[model samples]
Target chain A: MSRIPEETLRVADRLAAAMAREMRDDRVAGAALPLALLAALLARALYAPDLVVLGSLGLPLAPSAWWPGSGFRLSLARAEALALRHADGRFALEDAFASVFRGRFAIWISPAQVDATGSANLSAIGDWRRPKVALVGSRGLPDDAGHIPMRYYLPRHEPRHLPAAVDFRSAPGRTPEDGRRGRRRGGPEVLVTPLGVFRFRPEGVVADSLFEGVTPEEVTRRTGFPVTGLPEAGRTPPPTAEETAWIRRLDPFGIRALELLPPREARLAAAAIAEAEGEGM
Target chain B: MLASLTDVAARVREASKAGRLVAFGGSGLHRKPLRAAEAIAEAAVPDLRLLAPLGGPEVDLLVLAGLVRRVVFSYVGFEFLGVAPAFRRAREEGAIEVEEWSEFAILAGLRAGVLGLPFHPLPGPATGDLARTAPLAEVRSPYAPHEPVAVVPALAPAVAIVHVPFAREDGTAFVPGDPYADRLVGLAADELFVTCDELVGPGEVPGPALFLAAEVTGVVPAPGGSCFTASPPFADLDVRGAIDYLESVEARLARPSARAAPGRAGGGRGR
Candidate 1:
C-alpha cells in the first residue's frame, strides 16, 4: 500500500538488519547512529505517537551519511535548517539524566566495550592512569544505567567488545546482589549486535535470536563470555519489503551504507594522509 | 556597554588571578567562546579553577597552557576524535587538581546555584569513584530515612563565558541553535560575558533571548569566534580545521621539547 522507493528500502534493510530487535517502548534517546536511525523509522512505521528521539549536538535529525572520511552530515539541507530553526525542540545535555530519572524514557547506548553482565566501558582500555587507548570519557552512561533502563547497540560484534569484564565500569549493569539497586534504578535489558540479539539475565546474557546467515558458533566465538541459555536458534525477523521501501524514502541518500563498514577501516581509508599521498604522487 | 574581545578576556584574566572559578558553556564543539577563553589562557593567570559541564578543546588548551589550577567537570575528551591530549597528560602527571562530578551532578549543581539552593538531591546509588571524590554527600531523606539520596553542592562560578550567534549592545544574546546549558551558566555565574558573531541594536537581535542583559556583564562581537565549533547562520563546524588543529596538537605533543612549547599556546586562531 506504500509508495516508497525500492532503493530506499535496500538501504533501510541494511540498517534494520543491524538493529534487528524490537524496543520495549517507542521513545528513546541516544547519540545519532545508523542503528538509531533505523529504530526511529521503525518506531514511526508502527504509528507510535510517543516517539521522541534526542540527538547530540550537530547530529542530523534523520539518517545521514558522512562522506568517506568527512564525518557525518545531515542528509537533507532543508531538514538541517528546520532542525536549527526549531532548536528549542532539542533537549539540553545537562538535563539528560533528569529526563532519564523522570521515567518513561529509554536510552540506547553504544559503548566501546560491554561485558556478559551488561556492564560497559567507554572511558579507556588497559590501566586507567596510562591507558593503551583513551576514548571519550564516560558522559552519562553511569547515571543513565544506574537510574533508567538502557539497551546496547553494537554495529560490529567482536570478541574485544563482548569481553568477560569491561576494563572500566563506566556503567554498572544489573547483578543478583544489585536487585534492590536495580529495582530502584533500572539497568540494561537487551543488547543488539550485528550478529544477533541478546538479553541480560541474572545468570548471564542469553541469546534471544540470531540474524539470518549468522551461526550460533560464530556468535559464541565472537563473544568473550559463555552465552548461557541459548534460545532455540531462531532467525531474526527480516524487515518487510514495504518497510524497507518506506525507510529508504525517509533517507534518500543511502547514508546507511556508511555504517555497513567498520569505523576503523573507514577512517583509515578516508584519512587525509592517504589522500595527500595519492595527490603528491 | 559593548566591550572589545581583548577587554573581555582581560576581565576574565583579572578574575582568574583572584582564584575564582569560571564556567564555560557548550558541549563538544557547540557554542564555545574558545577565542576569549584562549585569550585568558594566553594571559597566564594563576590560581584559576574552571567549572565546565562538559570539556572540549577550550579546556584542553587551558590545561596545556598551565593556566588552570583546578577543574570541576564531568568528562574531558575530544568526543569521537579521542581523549583530550593535554587533560590526559596533566592528569597523569598530577599537574592539576580535579573535582569529578557526573554530568547530571554538574547540571544540578548549577541549577541549585541559579535557584540559590544549598544543594540538589540526585536519586541513585552514590558509590561510584566520582561520587566519592566530588562534593556529593549522602543523606537520609527527611520524608523517608530509608531512602538515601546523593546531594551535590551548588556551584556559583565567578564568571561564565558563552558564544552566541547575535547580541545587542545592551548585552542580550541570541543563540540560533540549541542553547545547551548556556542560560543556566549565565544565571549561575556572578558575571556573564557573551561573545557573538554580530553586534546589533536591542530590537534587531533574532532568536530567543538566551542571556538577559541584567545578568550579562559584557558583550563582545568576535566573528567566527567558535571557529571549529558551529556558530550556525555564521558557519558550521569547521571539521577540517578541527582535524588540522588536532593533528598539530598531536605533533607538538610528540616533539622532544613539547613541554617547552608553552609559548606557542593561544597562538593559533579559535578551533
Candidate 2:
C-alpha cells in the first residue's frame, strides 16, 4: 500500500471519526442508521411514513447520522441526533410514500451548506440507491428566516384525517422558490462549522461579522468544497395572525428519504410544512 | 509500456487530441486507489468530452472544471463505489447533461455495444422512474423496456487497456469477475493492452482465467506502471509519476477541442 501524505491521512481520519454518530435510541435504530435515516427523513419531510428505502450506494447519510429521534435545534447548548424505535418491517418502493406521509415535513441541509463541513455526508442527500442517513443541519435546524407557511397544527396534505402546522422560514434554504427573491434561495441560512459559525443564502455566504476569525477560503475548503451565497442581514418578516391560526399539527421524522423533495430545487422543494405532532426532523 | 500513470495520461491526452471519442467504464472507487485516481485524472481532461454512465467526481470535474464538454450517464451517485468528491462538484455546477438508466439497462447497453448489436430490447418492470429517464427502453410488446435495445453499435476503442493481477509474454490472461464487458471492449479494439502484476505463465491462469485465455492480449509488464483502465481487484499508478504527468498536462484537459476521429467501436466478446 502507498504511504499516504499526512494531509490526506488527516482528512481520512477526520472523515472516519465524524462517521461515528447516531440519532436514535434502539438497537435497530443505532445499528440501522442507514434504514432509519431513509425512512425517518422521508416520513417527516414529505409526510409519507410508508415509503420503503431500497439500497442506494454512495449515499453518505448512512455512516453520518448514526442514530434516530434527533432534531437540529439551534437554541440548545448541546445536541443529540438519534432516538429509539423498533425496526419497522422491510420497505417496498412500489408502495406510494407520497400518500403515506401525506402531510409531514422534515428539513434537510447538505454538508456543503453547513459549517460543520466534516459533519455533512456529501453523498447522503445526493444518492438514491442506499437507505441513507437523514441527520441534516449538521449546521442547524431550519427557522423562519424568511418564508412561513403559517405553521399549521396537523399534517397539511392529509387534510381530512390529520392536520399540522410549523414555522418553516428562517430555518434554512428558501422554500417554494419564486416565493422568495433569490436572496433566500439556494443556500443554507444557519451554519455550525468546525471552524466557527456562519450563514448562507442566494446572495452569498458570509461569516457572521462577529466571527471574523475565519477566512472564506478556509471555510470553503474545510467544508470539502467551495461555498457561495448566504442569507443577508435584512428585515425580518413576522407571521400574520391569520397565518398563525392555520398551523395546527405536525408529523415529522416518520418517513423515508425518497419521499422528500430536493431541498433546493424549485420543482422539488417541500410544498407544505406539517407540525412535528410527535415526530422529529 | 508506459513507465507510469503519467505516461498513461499522456497517451489519453494524445488520444483525445487526435479526435478519438474516448469512452471509460469501471465499477466504483473503493479499495482500489491507484486505478481510481488514474481514472479520475484521465476523465478530468479539459478539452475531451466526458462520456459516463452518470455524473460524479470525474464526470463532474470534467464538466465543472471545463475539461469536458458533456457527460452521458444514468446515475452518477449510484455508480460511485464509496468516495466521490469530483462527481458531486460537477453536478452542483449544472455544467452537466443528464441521462438516466437502470443497472440492468446500463449493463445491457454495454453488452449490446460489446455484442455489436444496434440496440438491445429490454425486459423488466417498465414503470415509474426508470421509464421516464430511459425513453429508448420503451419498445413494442416483444421489444419491451429494460431489455438490451435491438442494436448497440460496437464500442471499438482506438486503444483499450485493463489492470489485472497477471499477464504473460504470449498475451493470454484472466480477470477476477464476469469478463463480459472487458471481453466486448477487447473484441471491439484494434489494439488491446493489459497491465498486470507480472508476466505469469499457465501456473497463474486458474479457475476463470484458465478459460479466458484466447480473448486477451499479453500483459505489458512495467514495475512502476499503473494499469490505467478496466478494473476489479484494483491497482495504482506511481504517485510521484502521476503527479508529474498530470501537473504538466493540466492545460490540455481543461478546454478540449472537438477533433476526435472516432474510429468504429464495433465488435463482441463472444462469451
Candidate 3:
C-alpha cells in the first residue's frame, strides 16, 4: 500500500465528511442529482465508472442476501473494512451481493411506494401484520440504504406510488433524527419516472427536469406529495442521434422502452417483439 | 447415481409422496431446473410445500399445476414481465399458504439447515414488514446482549431439484459463476437431485467443480433442461418461449373449463 501524505489524507477525509453531510441533507429526486453527485465525485477525483460498484446490470437474479459463501455475509463492520481497502481507485467485481454488503455501490431499484423523505416501501401496501397486498419482502434495502447510494426507477410516477409517507420503510431515507445523528452515508440519489426526474430536498421532492412533452403541471398534479419544480428545471434533453442509433442497435426488440411505456402498450410491444423473434427463428 | 429423466422424475414423486417440502434451485430466470419441475407437474403431484430463495417459472409452474400447498420464498416473479401469473393468481385466490422472507433470510435458513443448527441469526436489525410477517425470531447474542439478532429457523427441504450446465455420472457438477444458493439447497435437502444439460463422462467434466456431489442423490442428463430461463454454453434465455408460456398459461386460466381443471396431468405440454 502506498503511504499517503498526512495533509492530503486530512484534506480527503474532510472533503468526504462534508460530502456525506451534503448527501444526507439532499433529498433525492431523479434527474439532476446524478450530475450533482458526479460533479462532487469528480471534485474528489474519485469518479471512475469501473471503480463504482453496481447492484445489477439487468440480470434476472435479485441481488443476493446474507450467505457466507454465496452472498456477502451481513456484517457492516467487516464490510466497512472491505470498503476501506477499495477506497483506492480500484473496485473488485467479485459478487453483486458482496459489493452491496460492502455498502460501496449504487442501485436503481423499483419500490412499491416512495415518500418525500425518500423512504421506500417494497414490503406490503396495508398493515404490517395482515397486509391486503404483500410485495416482495425487503431484500437488502434495509441494510443497504443507510450505507449505499440508491436511485429509484419507477415506470409510473403517480400519486399511488409517490405517497406522502410510505406504508413501510423498507429502505430508509434521510430524516431529522438521521440528520442529527449523522447516520446514513449513502441514501436516496434520484427517482426517475416517465414524466420527469425528481430529487429529494430538505423541503420535499423537487422536479429536476420534465421529460420531453411532459409538463410541470402534470408532474405536480400526479404526485401524492407537493412537488416543487426547480426554477431552472426544463425539458429533459432528447437522445442524440448517435445515442439513439446505439440504443436501437443494442435494444432491437425495444425492451428498455417497455419500462417507459404504459402497461397496455408494454404488453403489446412485448407480444410484437416475441412475434418478430418467432418469425426470425 | 446416474438415472434417466423419467426415473429421476419417479424418484421425485416417491420422495414427495408425503407432501414434503421441495425446494427448487436457481435464481430468477437463470438455469432453473424447469425440466424436472415439468416432470413433477406432469406427474400431477399434489400437496407439496414449495421453497425458493428467488423463483421464476419453476415456482410458478408448480403453482399453476395446483401441486403447491404452501410457498416459502423471498421473491417469485418474472424479471421484467411483471408478477408471476400463477403465483399471483394463487395468492389472490388464497389457494396456497405464503411465507415470505428476504433473500438473506432464506439463505440464512438454508445455512442453518446445512449446519444442523436450529436457527441462524442475520446480522443487523430486521427491517420493514418482513420483520413482522416473516418466520423470524429475535434473540440477543450472549456476548453482545445489547443487539438483538433476527433469527430464521432451519429450512431443510425433503427434496431439492437443481439444474447445472455440466455434470458427471457420479453426480459431480461444474457450476460456473454464481451457484445462486444451489449448493445451499443441495446440502439442506434430504435428497438432492441435479438435472444437467450435458451428462459428460467422469474425465470430461470441465471447469472448477465446487458443489455437493456427495449430497446429490441422483443425476439426470437433461439437455436444454433450463430452457426459457438460461443454461449458458447451450443457449441464453429463450425470451420468446418464456413469454409465450406465460401468455398461454394466462389464457388457459382465463378459460372457464381450465379454471376448475388445475393439477391435471399432461399440463406440462403448454411449455
Candidate 4:
C-alpha cells in the first residue's frame, strides 16, 4: 500500500477524536465518526421512518444492508450499482422517475457544482455546446429537483464545487425562480460535505452543523460564496454505539475508505481490502 | 421462428439504411442487449440515430465505432464504473448530434409514442438547461392558460432492441427484475427485436411473461447476451469485464490512430 501523508493521518485522527468526544457528550443524534461524512449522514437519515432514498450514492459497499427497513428502493442503478444493493429490490428508471415526479421519495444527488441557491449542475463544467469537461448530462435532475425533496452530498467541500453560481443550472434550487415557477416541494433541504452539513434557507445556504474539528472559519475559507449560520452552528452529531456497530458490521472491509481516501489510493486500498474480505468469506 | 445474432444485426443495418430511429433497451448498464449491440457494431451500420432513455456501454459502443450520427438520451454513463468516455468525447468534439432531456420527459415522449399521441404533457419543473437543449415546447392548457405544461413530442423509434433474460420460442419473454424501459421501447417501436440469454420450452420460463408473443417481431436466441451487464436470476454484472472494456476505451482514446473496429472489445465479455 502507498504511504499516506503524515499530515492527512493526523488530521483524520484529530477529527475522529473530536467526533467521538461530541457523540459521548451531547447524545443529540447518532452519527458514525470514523465513517466518511457521507455515510454518517446516510446513517442519520436511515433513522427517519419509512424513508425511500433514490439515486446511486457511489459508495464502495451496498447501502441496503445499512438501511433499517426491509428494503431500500434503489433506482436508476446499473448492474454494478444494483450489485451493491444486496437484498434490496431495484426500480426501473421510468418507475423511479414517476415516484420522484409525484414527490414520493427524497432524492439524493451528487453534483459537480452546487450554487449558493442550491441549484445543482450535473451537466458540464464549461460552455454547453463545447464544454471543457462534459460530465454526465442532466439525467433526472432537471425534471425532479424542483418538485421533490432533495438532499446533496459532496465528498469534498471546496470553493470550486461550492461556487457562487453554477455554470449551468441543471436543477433549480431555492432561488425565487423555483418558487415563482410553482409546486416547489422544499428543494435542497440540506447539503452534506466533509466539513459540515448545510441547510438551504430563504436567505441562502447556511451551516447547520460542522463536522468534528471543522470550524466556522474553515468553512468560510473553503466556501466560495457567503454562508451564514455558522457562529451558532453546533457539531454534527455522532452515531450511537448501536448505529456504529451496524455500520462497521455491514461494511467489514472499510468500504467507506473508497469515498474517504484520494482517488488513486482509494482504488488500491479498496481493491486490497475487497480481495482480503473475499478470501475470508 | 428464432433468429440468429447475424440476422439481428442485418435488421438493425436495414433500419439504419432507412434513416430510422433505433432504440436500445435498458438504463445505464443493467439488462442491455449488449451482444446485439456488439453485433450491430460488427455490421458497421452507418449514420444511425440512436435513442435510449438512459444508456451506457451499448450507446458508447456504437459511438466508439463511429456508427452513430445523432443520439437522443437523458443520461449515458456507467453508474459506478465511470462516465461514458466515448459519448462524452463525441459530444464535446461535436462529432455527434445530441438531444438531451430529463429522464421523465424522454420517458413521456416514449409514452406518447406508445399511446399514439402527437405529444405527452408531463407535470412540473421541466424547464431547465435540459429542457432548453431538448425538443420540448411549452403549451398552455386551453381551459387554464395560466398553467403551462412542457410537452415532449412522440418518440416513435423505427426499431427497438432488448436483451431478454429468459424467453421461449413463441416469443413469450420474462424480465427477471426491473424492466428498465424495455417494454415501453418495445411497444413504441415499429419493429421489436428481442435477444435472450436463455431460450426455454413451453411452460419453462422462470417468471411471468413481461413481453407478449404477439408484440415481438423477431426473437434472437443468444445465451449470455447481456453479459457484463445484468440480467438477474440468470447472471450478475461481470464487473471485471466491464472494467476491462472501460480501460480499453480509455486506452483507445489515448491513442487516436488505434481506432480499430470496436466489435467485442468495446462491449461486454461474450460469456
Query: Of the candidates shown, which would achieve the greatest lDDT relative to the real structure?
Result: 4
Which ten residues in a row are the worst by lDDT in model 4 chain B?
A: B262-271
State the lDDT of candidate 1 residue by residue for B97-133, as single tens digits.
8776777778888989899999998767753345544
lDDT of 2 at B63: 44
What C-alpha lDDT do the candidate models reach, one value each? Answer: 0.66, 0.31, 0.62, 0.68
- How many clashing pairs does model 4 include? 3
TM-score leader: 4
Would candidate 4 be rated incorrect, acceptable, medium or high by CAPRI criteria? Answer: acceptable
Q: Which docking band does candidate 2 fall into?
A: incorrect
lDDT of 3 by residue, A12-130 (tens): 23222223223332222111111222222222222232233211221112122111223221111122222222222222122344545556444457788998889998766766445
> Proportion of native contacts found in each model?
0.29, 0.00, 0.16, 0.53
Q: What is the C-alpha lDDT profile of model 3 across B90-124, one tens digit per residue?
A: 77667888887877778788889889999998655
lDDT of 1 by residue, A78-187 (tens): 22333554333555555555567776456567788999888887766776555666556666776776667667877578999889988877777766568664346667
Docking class of 1: acceptable
What TM-score do all the candidates reach, one by one? 0.83, 0.38, 0.75, 0.85
Model 2, DockQ value?
0.02
Q: Which portions of model 4 show Cα errors greater than 4 Å? A: A1-46, A52-92, A257-281, B263-271
Calculate DockQ per candidate and list them.
Answer: 0.31, 0.02, 0.17, 0.45
Number of the candidate with higher TM-score, 1 or 3: 1
lDDT of 4 at A219: 96
TM-score of chain B of each: 0.91, 0.57, 0.92, 0.95
lDDT (10s digit) by residue, model 4, range A5-65: 4444333333332333322211112111123332333433445323333223222233443
Cα deviation of A92, candidate 1, in Å: 3.8
lDDT (Cα) of model 2: 0.31
Per residue, candidate 2 scores C-alpha lDDT tens digits across A17-56 of: 1111111211111111222233233232233223322221
Best by DockQ: 4
